[model samples]
Target: MALAAAAFTAGCGGGAPRLASYVSPQFGYTIPHPAAWHRVETDGGRRVWFLPQAPPAAQPPEQTAVDFLVVMTRDDPGPLPEIDVRRLAMSLLPMHGVSGFQRAPRGNEEIAWYRFELTGATGGREWASVGLLVTGPKRLHYVVCAGALERWRTAQKVCDEVLRGFVPGDLSR
Candidate 1:
């Protein structure tokens, strides 16, 4: 894949970040992510990592993660003979409370992916998100990477890199 590395200017005035690869044997997938983001554990065996737009204050709050990437796996219900890209997009629309929902193209042949944008209802926040749906040998995989829409112009490159570098592993093991 032609995943060009475009220069990214941090919205928080931080320097350009170095990327690192995260490999999960259990989930059977590999993805490159920003080295600065902290990996946090969420429910349902899901892996979530996030980085705040700005540096933390002297006294950080309960949580600081803002922009994030999430990867999870589920059992594949076989091929989708009834679903096309548009129909799949419609079925996976962002949940309520996220307005201005729209889908774009994302991912590769092994992985059916889609891009979406939305405005948060509370603060009118803008977000850019990408979803990757992988039909693994024994299971299905989904990955999402999202960031502030204001930073998307520069962040899109990194997001693309993550998707392109993502390698699907054997979940049936």
Candidate 2:
């Protein structure tokens, strides 16, 4: 409900980004993302969009895509239930390596995180995850992350813009 933007090292350059407004009423939120980027829906029917991870290549469909999590549940009020969102994420990745993520820093409204690459074929994959963790009513914590190599340096601006654009709606009311 406030203007607390997420911070991370996902790279993209241009003027202030205006993300497209989310249409589905399921998410109950919307924000401005950069124009031109395409929103690719996943097979399971979860709303997904491109985060501009890599330059367009002639083949291989762009090794990866920086995507956002559930759209409707953007403002999850939790004492965080026994939800296995992490396990669900792991099942999506190629059946090769595992990721060991850890808490790196904590701020008043923002908690920065880091991911340790445990076993993977891709080189330099550790990421710092910056997201909003809603503790309860009016208590939302923003977080940011990136590859351990250049965590803060690379994600400074993009993290700010994305997190600031976060919006949530009241479902129970």
Candidate 3:
């Protein structure tokens, strides 16, 4: 975990362009990622995915599982609507080897989520990923899950930990 935190500090605090404070944020929250993961800053924003060298077994050995990609905008008004999200999701299916997608909701949020079932090479054959659209006080959360199929479903508790931790940074801070 130490390595993971170090990676985040180095990756997010280093000489990247200073991002202007988000304006009128709603769910603008930040979670101090645990020490075992790495912060992957994408064109969208900062992301945290598993360390490349971490063994696959390090994740829960289940049929399907949850991974995270939380995004906070410079301004958090709210999440995009379902129609837009669904369209956006469909756009990504082709990129991640997804054959197709079915739109759905994630709790109270209007999200167009889908799952991908593929083969896992390490004797696990069920692979799935879920796309979620979350609106908060200062950020829009997107959780794209990747894991073994059935196992991911059962790992809801694990994923909830990620969801429940969302907290808006002080607008004053």
* Candidate number achieving the greatest TM-score relative to the actual structure: 1
> How do the predictions measure up, each by TM-score?
0.62, 0.44, 0.42
**Between which residue pairs do clashes occur in model 1?**
none
lDDT for each candidate structure: 0.51, 0.35, 0.37
Model 1 lDDT, residue 39, Cα: 59
Deviation from truth (RMSD, Å), model 1: 7.6
**Residue 104 C-alpha lDDT in model 2:** 32
For residues 39-102, write the lDDT of model 2, one tens digit per residue: 5444333344444333245422113422222221324343233133344324433324434544
RMSD of each: 7.6, 9.5, 11.6
- lDDT string for model 1 (1-173, tens) is 01112224442455555778888756757888777666554444554444433325552211332255666666665322224433543343242333332332443444344334332211244456655655533565556666556666666666767767767676444
Judged by lDDT against the true structure, how good is candidate 1? 0.51
By lDDT, the better pick of 2 and 3 is 3
Clashes of each: 0, 20, 25
